[model samples]
Target: MRRPHGVLRTADVEHGHDLLPPTPPTTVGVIEAVATGSPRRVVDQRANAARVADLFADPAQRQRIPRIYQKTRIDTRHLAIDPLEPEFLEFSRKPATIRERMNLFFEHAVPLAVDVARRAVENLADPAEEIGQLIFVTSTGFIAPGVDVAVVKQLALSPTVNRMIVNFMGCAAAMNGIRTAVDYVRAHPDKKSMVLCIEVSSVNAVFDDDVNDVITHSLFGDGCGAVVIGANQVHQPLAAGSVVIRDSFSHLFDDAEDGIVLGVKDTAITCELATSLPDYIYQGVDPVVSQVLARNGLDKAAVDLWAIHPGGPRIIEESARSLGIPPEAAAPSWDVLAEHGNMLSVSLIFVLERMIRDTRSAAPISTGVAFSFAPGVTLEGIVFDVIRS
Candidate 1:
């Protein structure tokens, strides 16, 4: 029998390889690696948007929601809770209590966090036991011991591993998580760190006729993103190849707090999103790019790829306009939003993860600039250098 073309034996799998393509030889540099976890549920935007619009109880708002959902550029998303589930959907008939919402948060977020955390660790080809610290980021819910403890237990990291939580930080929480981990690794170069972001935006669903609730339902989704950064004294691979954290920067638009908001009321997370978000985001991100680039003695032209947060389609356009870059530069952000509606803190990291892979095998891998926004009108940015062999 003729052997299959280039068939290889599947035995000694002990070699140092990861999910990502290995870096070419003659160059060993640090890299930042990431992975994503599957959401518990999937939702179709066009259909769910219509259903959520009906919950408005007002025909005017119902008619308006479709246009808004269509304009969002999101066709689908993964949700932690089913929108059509009787328990969650009966909000108009009987509003969901805080306890019920919190229940969904715990039930869904715990396992989701564990899965994403594991994927992150597995991607590194580094042992999980060596992770010096665990950082958890979430804006959708709160707990006493919080999601960090559960994540460590499931991931089986050091029981004594340092734990930190970046909660209620909104979409930018993942950046803060990475920033915290980077700070730790900088101090303890021998140690590695993991940052996990899990958002269950569906659990925060509001069942009332409020315009904000309808808008929130139409916009947000659920999922988790995890990353492992090399902080050792020597440059370590954050992923399979040579991707290093060149720099990261964040800024807050003064008096712009009113633009986006997340709050808790009677158990479920409450949202206060402004319609003028695109204008605000465009205005906010331009300076952030300049500030981050200038500090590194670089400019917009030096960036080969962009991990822009797709807070929305309009926001993506605004981000591109703000940076004065071509519309294609922000294409990846829009792609993420289209494939999966904004997953809050989990959203931007997804964009970055793909950029990391794209850099590995495609153009625009080097000098990647990542950007995401959170409440407090905060703009978080990070720069990555994919040093290929």
Candidate 2:
């Protein structure tokens, strides 16, 4: 059956409350630049796949777990600091019990973040006055004078520029940043916004031999992605196929907080990701997307592009299967995962930037959906249409 347009038939929200206002006719431009701190080293996936097999040589783990890990298609990952080195490992084990690992993590993470933010702003042709807001998203590390303050100092954005800092939310937090910027543009159509996401996933490493922790250690990489979004007046024209923001929807699953969590224990940060994540996505996303489309008076078939967070191979596959999206629709996401592992919140934007660059053909109106999952078992989605020049 064909689904109704972007209206809500679901029980979550009643019909009378004020819906978010439509995106203004004003155009928003996006500039994406990525920076990494990993040593100039690369990991070969073919060899790592063999190593994984050898490590989990036990019968059951070898059979069931290795198959799932192999599906991630991650050949090798880059680390801010090598994980195999004795000094790093020793630091992970004990650091005089006085110097906390969180402090050490922040020391390495903040500078990289500042550098990426500067590059993104510097790449823009417009003067600093053109950017009205700056939003920073990160879950990897925290410092007193955070990215918001750091970015302002480094980029020299105007003192009047609005600033927001979002912390602790995991991989999907970037969607929240985009949603905030979209709302900012809608309210003040002439204003521009910048979003910077930096995640030093290596810092959060648990240094444990547990299978789940090992899997996480192997899957995440350290990277930062920064983008500028706002009126195009002072910036380069958005490329021919750039994705434009239209609308967004967010849903938090009930009683599922325990399913995914990131927290600090002793001097190390630990991530607890339940194996049931695939099941959560399978159960919730279909209805959520349907409701989002219904509100915009759009049907599922109307969506022409999909930019899903490359959380992992199984999560991506489950999302595709649940949404009935073709493999081609999610190819960019897969490519991001293969090339960069999960850079937490930055991964979605990385994939979206690629889609915007690759799309060429035109239709009446093309809609793209970007979705991500994180702690709180939250599923956030944004729907945007291509703006013709």
TM-score computed on alpha carbons, candidate 2: 0.81
Local accuracy of candidate 2 as per-residue lDDT tens digits, 1-389: 77564455545256542365644444444333333333244665555444544545467755554555566688666667665556766766663422355576667766777777666667566637777888888887766666577667766778888988888788888888888877776567666677888777676565544567567766887777776665443234555555566677789987788767987666566677887888888888888888889887888888777888888887788888888876667888989899888878988877876766663655634578889987999998788765445
* Pairs with steric clashes in candidate 1: 30-236, 31-238, 31-243, 32-238, 33-238, 98-267, 359-365
Error at 133, model 2, angstroms: 1.8
- Candidate 1 lDDT over 202-266, as tens digits, reads 87776555666666777888889888765533443343444677776888887888888878777
RMSD of each: 12.6, 7.2
Model 1: runs farther than 4 Å from truth? 1-31, 91-96, 123-128, 232-240, 359-365
lDDT per prediction? 0.75, 0.71
Identify the candidate with maximal TM-score: 1
TM-score of each: 0.86, 0.81
